[model samples]
Target: MRYLFPTGKGYQRKWLGQDVLSGVVIAAVSIPISMGYAQIAGLPAVYGLYGSLLPVILFALLSTSPQFIFGVDAAPAAMIGGVLGGMGIAMGSAEAERVVPVLTFYVGVWLLLFALLRAGRVLRFVSTSVMGGFISGICCTIILMQLPKLMGGTAGTGELPELVRHLAGVQVHPLSLGLGAAALVILLAAKRLRPKFPMAIVVMGLGALATVLFDLPGHGVACLGAVEPGLPALHLPDWSAVSLTEGLGNSLPVAVVIMAETLLAESSFAMRDGYEIRDSQELLAFAAANLGAGMVGCCPVNGSVSRSSMNVQYRGKTQAVSLVAAAGMAAVLLWGSGLIRLLPVPVLTAIVISALLGAVEFDMAHRLLRADRKELAIFLAAFLGVLVLGTIYGVVIGVLLSFVDVIRRASQPSRELLGVISGQPGFYPLGRMSQAHPLEGVALYRFSGGLFFANIDRFQKDVENCVKPGIRAVIVDASGIVSVDLTSAERLVLLYRRLKEQGVRLYLTEHIGQVNDELRRFGAGELIEEGAVRRTLYAALEDCGAAEGEVKQWIPEEMRHAVPELLRQTQELEWAYGEEAQSKLDAMTGQVLQTLEETKPEQREQELEFLLERGRWQGVIDRDAILQHLEEHLAELSRLLERSEDAVLLELEQERERVTEALRRQHPEIASYLAAHREELEQRFQRKYPEAARHIHELRQRLHQLPEDETKEQR
Candidate 1:
């Protein structure tokens, strides 16, 4: 009950005026839009009005978000219209009226079932691409469906192509077409001029006035004739005319569309408004609203994104705005029936078309084209699927595409080839740091996603890609791994044994909390040595005989005071498992310190490089000292680059150009690989420095012509 009736603890008396005004404005907006959506759903305009009234009231009472408004949304309405249209039911017929409530009831039942089963979590599997595709497809289908009316004729049946064919053959009504065009232009202009303007009200008022003044109805314009309204009756669905089985089957698609659209809107609003709404709670609210709509003999309701946006714009403080909107809708139901009848059908269709213009996602297509081709394919497939097979089939295709994408992502989780940067605190991916290197004879790999049964072999292959014969040890950075299933554990066991057979030891570090227990249960201790699972990455490196260096040698005596004592302590300890290595490390540090004192300042850098090389060969050097030296080298390079036209820089640039030309001529494979991945480089650079990306492209173009210019001169 608490979940159903959200608390109004933060409600302020100061906000009542804003809330009431917003409610009235929202009510004014939703009335015409909802009625238009109802006409799209093959029901009477009164149903759209009734849907706005009671469903809005019920949902506002039961909603988790205080600002969210529920009513006739275009996507679900179009879906219902498409489904019923396919059933050969005539619009506004008694049979169509009967089917709507039954379908609404079935949709309500499905929403309730989803809420009870807590199936909203399944929504996560439906990616943004899928939803975007589904919505865009529905928008196109709705636009296509409404075109006949927009042209001043009866709505056509069948798929988009067939409808287009029918539209080609059908005679166009000149007067109605002009009226629709005028209304579309006015509505669009009003929206552009004042985005917050009560567009539907102004448009409907103008159309009604124009009908009266210009005698539009007498000129062959089809007005919404004789709307009988005064609030819908509360009653259970009469299942005698419609089969429950068929109704439920058809309602499934409608329910899916409603749930998807509602949750998407709800989540978006919640994020935008700085509040949290549980998905399960949202489903329950939807269930209650639709069930209320069904009881009132109206079409199913959903969270209206347009109305919600208005609610936010109007600064609606609480659910009171929805109730106020409901009040306005109720007033219209009793006294405004005549006004609705005065509205031209073409004008109403224009309203629908104008509203749908917002839903058609060209921007989404552009973004996907820039970011991901695979998702773009899915979007196009879902879009074309709808144009050919209808909304239900399109949704099915979109969902399937989303699932396939999920599988593709999981089965090929990105891996990081990790290495230590000279002065960095922790290990980073080698792909990110060019100057970093792995511990000698040790390969560190980090899988950047969850480990599961479906991706076990993928994990194995990723590990193998980083392995080479000379690698004496392999350390996996398990920091990113949150969970591990049994199959993945078994695969890891196999990888351990395989590496063992190759005389390479496998070590695991940064096991996520509780995953350590999971590893042990999988006999990880038996597969590797008892002490192989180290607490830290550096400890693992030392355990594998990779970190061989005295800590004191890495720190110059003067700068030792600036270095944190904890880092010094960490570097001093050779291995994690026992204290035995510490005594040996202390003795080594003493010997290195004695050698460093005998060395002069000028030869100190050279001596450190010698130690680093020796460590790489026979395994022991001051890793801290090598890191400090690498930092100095990086600083020196930065200074050199800052000189802009230093002789050294000029020579390096010339040599680089020579090497690039040589590679282009002699190693086309390498050149081709670079060319193929150039876009990837550009994308990364664009993300990091958007302003520089264009300049970089210009520079590359100029550089590419250098060889051509030389060739032209020679010729």
Candidate 2:
């Protein structure tokens, strides 16, 4: 199980049963709605049924998650509907029918290409706020569009004028309206009951039963009527209709929109349920499903969030559930597709209304309240754009806003002054602490972000902005800086010269080694005198003052407000065994220790590098020196430990808990890596010399046997 998804095997086995039941129930309830969606997409009702059948099978076969049921979904259906409606391609027309296959083919190919490109990881870059706003917009549009369809012909088709004309042509179908409302009510109840016991399936069944029992076909109620059943026809994706000048018109853009929605839906529903599949794979899955669906005269298809969620709720752990759903849907299309026509339209409408209840954006609204003003503006703007303009245009607008935000932030930059307070030890910016006292003269300013071309001038201006008269020196705390370019380095040289002329010394503190190497290579280091670059600000201050006074001032009276980088993550700071790093280290060390037990005078040489990726190896007062002093104290001890040779290295590792607890009393953020099998420790003590092993064992005992006199004096 750990190998499958980096966890235990138990969870996967458990969810398998849940997947099957969830798939079946969701498919049963979704059958009717799929047809309505197909109708909206300008496909024949049978095409929707065809889509529910074959595409589901293909999606199941290709998807990573058993529970991910891909078929015709509402957003893309409305998208297709709105696009074709604008194009004046009404249903039952030869032009519309011809274009439908082309659209589906286009949608399929694009999804396939996206899947091939492995675009799923891009989902991480999409903030939750953007997704929330996008979904809210989609829901708003969908609800408004469905209002007419539910009004029993009062709201069906046409613009304001055409709706008015249609209304005049057809009177109020009261029985149909009441039945639709009832379907909505029952559908909601079933979802509330449980995913497995679908109210929609039960309610729709009752509506059909009422039709048969009361002979509703004799009344004015509408029905799904007959749909033919068979295997899907083979299809070749068409680009013959595509124009170089105009491209494929609406299909190309619509296809992109559909693909985005499909991937997003699959990730949120399928991946959230622990489906270990790539985004691109799901994209290919959609492509295959749609291609197969289109060829068979089925509507275009994509991943279904509601159906997928139902499967997850039921504990469907694999793609097998999708296969089952497809089989069941196929049987329905083959056997009872015609009986669906006998069901009243009002019942169908009610089911749709109830299904839509699940689409409410209450969470989105709550999150929006927590968002900053800028993010809220973006969310609201996106919401309005989709509601008023349309889905495609709204996303474009949101993207545009995001780009502007990026440019705006880059153009305006910030810096910080890093310093330690008087009679205090640990370093921090004095400015940000509202009540904290500054150390009078000293300031350790940081250019917090990277030094790039866009912000170099602004950075320099802020450097000057921070520097005022009578300051002895301005320390450019290069600890926060990661990398520097030649342009910035040259500018730094000029600034260094200017500061020197003014009798204000410039010092580079806690410099990244590689960056200094780069500066040396570029000869930028020579522009500034060598002595000005100190190991740390304290040592720099002390070289100009008395060293004894500075050395005595190093220890802090209390803990710093902000912890150091290595200690920032509190869990990582813990001394617990069986941790990720510790486990890995343990495994590594156990292998070495096992070899060490029988090894001769083995001479081994390893070419290894420990690049200073974050911190400086050298400083005014090197922290590494402080760390080494702590390690030396740890190494010299008098007590001894007994070895149990037969025990697994893993079991033996847990004994470090006692020693770990003792260390925490002093350096509370210390991490014990006995399980982590730190190679350096073993190489130096356990392998290099026999006496080192004695030292480790003795120290383990010493930690538990701290001298009472020393402990009391320290307290």
Candidate 3:
């Protein structure tokens, strides 16, 4: 019993007063919006009130959600109205009234079946982007449908094109248009100024007062004629007016919309409030509410986001708020129904339009635009599909698009070439990390996402592209690949054979134990027996004779000249400025040399500094690298000029010393940073390339001995 009626589980005495106040607020807000939605559903406005009373009470009694409110809402109503228009049923006529109740009965039946089947879990596949787009599209379509009524005409029916045509042909009624425009403006302003205020009721009351004060109905402004003063009568849905097949067919989509929209909203509220809702119970609650709606001759009903938000804002803590709201509506139906007759049709249309406008997912569209363009496209497709096609087709298009997006991503997941940085422990993507370089005769590859028939070809192609003449071993980092299908396993075996034929060993590394079992099951157990599968990349590299050796000898020949840190920085420059980065640096060096030759001796330092500033070389290359390159260029210039080598070198060294001193004085921090960075790079180079470090030390010691020998001979 506690599980069935969970609302009282956490109830408190103090919450009752707040819940009652919130319930009243919800009733006030629901009056105008539900009435508008009833018109959208092709029912009389009074049915909207009936829907609010019984359906809400039933939902409150059964719902696992303590705070979620259910009643006649926009999506299900718009869907019902669309189906009616398609069937050539006239709005508010006897046929529409009969068909709508039958349709509501079918919708209730569907929800009950869904609850029984525990089918609420299937709703997880519906993406938020698709829902936002679908709802936005529905809201826009209903807004267009309501526009004609605001101008003293009947509401437009069918999809966007027909609605546009009806809007284009609408004859302007000055008084009605003015009243609608003013009501719309006031509602919008009040929403902005005080979001939680019961402004819809206030606007509705003002419109009703205007109708009575000025006799606006006499001046060609249509008003709701009269409302019967009583509670709704309970009756079984009469199905003789519409065929069984047509009623069932039309009602399924309405049922789907109600289920999708309500459950999504319910789940969102549950998440926000840090509570858990039973999805199956929520479905049951919807079924019961809609069945109650059908019994009362009301249109299909669903959860109302606007009223639920208002309830939460007023600190309504339990389902008592829903009961209180039902009572408030019952009171209006019993005594205050007469005032609804004085409500102007245009004003009601404006209120409906305002409510629908709030329902549109404008903020969602904005977020998708900034975060992911692909998701935004999905949103647009759903929105446009609903606008161009009808609501059901729009939902189909959005869902189809979502599934296609999923397939597309799976078919082409991110893949990268892995390499090792000199001082870093783990393998990194060669393209992204500047200091990372491939080990000679071995390729480390990382493929992100599962291997399946759809993506195996991509995986094979990427691996083949990474293979070159000297690459004797290929190690795949399979940490990202969680699962493999039969087709992918076959393809993997073929790839291994192909690589083996070409004298290249293929090893799969860093995969889970399940993958090994899968490989064995797929008839690739030979791979494991042959020692091609390993637990880690380092182990694979060790087997391939790549790890625990001189890093310079293992690295590519082109990368062997510089320290790994410097090589990394240079690669970064190449990535940013393109492959011509080295050529550009040389060109800038030539320009600086020309400036130094052209300038007077006194201005040479100033000219060189100006040339360096203009070159913007520091943005691309480090200060230490630039200084080393300048010294090399000066040596080359002296050799090309064929001057006395020692004399030319002495003069160049003095000039360099003076300029370096001036630069250090002008920018001491930069000079200090470059000096410290150079020292760190040298240390890393010595650690990574000990043999080369020893050779350089020997050359420096020999040079020092030669100078001492010359001094001894002179003595």
lDDT of each: 0.69, 0.57, 0.75
lDDT score, candidate 2, position 51: 82
Per-residue lDDT of 476 in model 3: 95
> If the candidates were sorted by their TM-score against the true structure, best first, what order would they fall in?
3, 1, 2
Pull out the clashing pairs in model 1. Answer: 548-620, 548-621, 549-621, 554-625
Per-prediction TM-score: 0.69, 0.66, 0.70
Encode model 1's per-residue lDDT on 239-353: one tens digit a residue: 8867878989989878887777677556545655689778887888889899999988888888775567667655688888988899988887788777766778888777767
TM-score, candidate 2, is 0.66
TM-score of 1: 0.69
Candidate number with greatest lDDT: 3
Off by over 4 Å in 3: 5-22, 32-44, 64-68, 74-100, 238-250, 264-277, 305-321, 549-715
Question: Candidate 2: deviation at residue 71, Å?
Answer: 1.4
Question: What are the per-residue Cα lDDT tens digits for candidate 3 across 224-304?
Answer: 756688998999988797788988888888888777767766765676589988889889999999999999999999987
If both were scored by TM-score, which would come out higher, candidate 2 or candidate 3? 3
By lDDT, rank the candidates, best first.
Answer: 3, 1, 2
State in Å the error of residue 182, model 3: 2.7
